[model samples]
Target chain A: MDLQKMMDLPGALAAFTYSDKGDLQSHVLREGTELTPQVLDLLAHSCVANQAIASMEARGWEALTGQSGFQPLKGFSMVGLEWSVVVDGNCGVVVKNRDADYEATFNALQAA
Target chain B: MHIVKQLMAIPGVVAAGEYAYRGDRFSYEGALTDEFARMASILCRANTLSVNMQSEIFDSFAENIGCRPVQGWIVRGSQITICAVGNYFAFIENRDELLNDVMTIMRAKVGDVQDDLLVNLYARLGGDTKEALY
Candidate 1:
């Protein structure tokens, strides 16, 4: 995923890619944002955990309910009090809550 | 109407429910069987715990960057999306504008999640909030 392009998203404070095990791989931070690499690393790890859990839930829910259209998970977002992180696969973008466009962010992640 | 009923009224909302903070009990309506709803309750519990911890960690790092008291979460699958706000969870189809619509109503209905996590949830579930000491 192109971290720079992810940065172009509205209200994006930082965009990052992480390893399958949740180590921060690469990132770009908008200058003057209060975020630090250390925090982003933690965020990356949390994103990974959230994704894995959500994917498992999707698979199990579909199978148990005999439902369709739930496999191939797309993305997950944590809606914080003032900001949020949207993550898909190994990449994620943190956006200011007031400016978050959930659909656009999910589409961007999917395209990447 | 109750919040769960309100959510179920939305066009693409297939299942809506109120789940326990620890995944022990739940009640749901619409397409899911009882066993499926129980699994959904467990899933919501896991996601809630994960996000609450992350919120606390973020708060510690930034000292009130407004990431505290997580409002909710959403997971979008290929054609189904699950959204949880407060103790309520909804599974909806991915038709155009459905996610946004369902999210808007859910957020408006549930309001903000309390910082007193366990206490707030227990109070809502009829437990003694003061004694919980959460």
Candidate 2:
């Protein structure tokens, strides 16, 4: 996906794509934003770590219930006072404003 | 113990537990096996640590643009929902439909008992029991 174009959505302050191992793959930041690559790497790893935990939880459930075909997680969202982060797999989008339309932003990200 | 029991009392709360940031379970109650519950608690602690780290990074840039600190995180999956309250963690299973309501109740219940919880945790760690009361 064209990550930069996807990041151009309204209220999107920054976006990053990482490998399954949490390595930084690509990123976009709004002009004048003070975020750094090191910080971005930390954020990416955090997202991947979250994904791993969710995956484990899913496996645990499958084991307990004898249920097969557990689907991997699509993504998760964290809302803060000033920003909201949505992470899907290795891709993460950080909205500038807490009130940003996360649903639309997520839809746009997926469609992109 | 009381907190776990209260959390378990809530509708759809399949499991409730308290764990240290280092992955030690203070208490837990649910249908999950002991090993599975411990793993979940530890994973939840890791998730919380990550959230806190992310928040700190954002805070460093808050001066450039006004931003408030992160309060907490809620990660909802198909079969479970994990919630972080303070340094403690809780997870619910097979209750995706009641996640929001359960979280709200759990948060409030946790708040009410956090002092006692901490005291007990302190004592469990072999800290001075008298100091824990304060």
Candidate 3:
């Protein structure tokens, strides 16, 4: 599915897709959103990196508890002063408002 | 340790800990076992790394336009919330919906101790420290 469809969600400022290797695959920013390409690239990479780290941490937890299998990390949401960024699988969406319902928006984006 | 205890006293905070930049748990309070504490530390450290990377990228881009880096960040999960405060990071595993309140209490208790924690972390790491803490 095209990640850009996330832009349809209210308050979504931008949507992006990236590989596990941090390579940007696609990106869409709302019109008049004054963000640079470098910033978008960085957000994408950070989202992917956050997922990688969370996965590692989850594995560590499973090892510590002797649980053979633990659910994989879905993504992470970082609440910044001005925006909230959420990443699921290989796709990320940035919402302009910090209080936006990122989890719901992310779910809708994935379900699209 | 005192700050950790205070954090644990907050409503909805199931576990609380103080961790170094490299995922070492210096002190913690709550129902977590030692192994779980270590895992929590690693998770919190990873959260901090993500925040730092994002800050760096935003700062670099902002610098070009006469702006500043982000001061801090909050990462919310299903049952956990991690907040980065300078060199040290603190997190609360909570089931209640008072994440902001928990973060506020954590920052109030541990915010000023960032330098002290960094020094202690440096001492524990045999003088090795991240340049950002300097």
Candidate 4:
């Protein structure tokens, strides 16, 4: 896949290119890759993980996305650093930064 | 000199020194000596983890890799131990994983987005310093 095609996915961060397979290997997004019922469970697991962490720190948690209309999850504090991962498509993980260059890299990934 | 260089390589390890690991008590202070748990939070942050979650992760990782979590010091409520005859270590996986885990806990508290970028960049530079000593 080329840069534009790979960037088609919303919230892409970075792309890992491989060799030999001649295709994109991985694409990373800020939120998650899928909204399907299967992924809902994983997303919930991630939420559980976050809640567990909050319990240990005596704090609460929330979630965020890039979409304009998307209401950011409540209970999240705009305080310290945080990270989220989502597995989608050929991409093994998705991160938060969604710059043009990052998108290009994901587009350039080769198949392994 | 080597120890300092190695410790500095870890993402969030501010400092390390000649931590005395006698019997069960450990202490460090000198030109190249530091105490345990002093940088537990920092270390945990760097590794994308927190003090409380590290023990279970480490234990699972040890079991997976067929190693033991030895006794050495306590940092941020997690036990710091040397593995592989004090050559390698048994802690969180890497900086990216650690930072990711931290961000998960913080729930976007700070710069979860930026941190993910920085952590990935640093992790890509690649070379496990904490375990390199082994």
Cα-based TM-score, every candidate: 0.90, 0.56, 0.64, 0.23
Best candidate, lDDT = 1
Tens-place lDDT per residue, model 3, A14-102, is 88877877777788887876666677677777777776766666566667776432344445666554566777777777776434554
| lDDT by residue for model 3 (B1-134), tens | 47667766776666666666567645677767787777767666656555755665677676432112232445544455555544334455534445546545544554433324335445545544556466
Error of model 1, residue A82, in angstroms: 0.7
For model 2, how does the per-residue alpha-carbon lDDT over B1-134 read when each residue is reduced to its tens digit?
Answer: 46677777777676677676356655678776777667766666666556655666656754433323443466655555566664455566544345545545554555522323334334545657675455
DockQ top scorer: 1
Candidate 1 lDDT, tens digit per residue, B1-134? 88899988889899999986566678899888888788888878778877898788777887877678988899998988888887889999887878767777877888888897776566666766686653
Q: What is the CA-based DockQ of model 1?
A: 0.73
Interface RMSD of candidate 3, in Å, is 4.8
TM-score of chain A of each: 0.95, 0.78, 0.82, 0.25
Residue B118, model 2, lDDT:
37
Off by over 4 Å in 2: A1-49, A56-71, A79-84, A89-112, B1-3, B63-71, B93-97, B109-134
| Candidate 1 regions with alpha-carbon error over 4 angstroms | B132-134
**Model 3 clash tally, residue pairs:** 0
List RMSD in Å for every model shown.
2.1, 6.3, 5.4, 16.8
Better of 2 and 4 by TM-score: 2
**Per-candidate local distance difference test:** 0.84, 0.62, 0.60, 0.27
Which DockQ value does candidate 3 get? 0.22
Write the number of the candidate with greater TM-score, choosing between 1 and 2.
Answer: 1
Off by over 4 Å in 4: A1-36, A59-96, A99-112, B1-43, B50-134
Top TM-score hit: 1
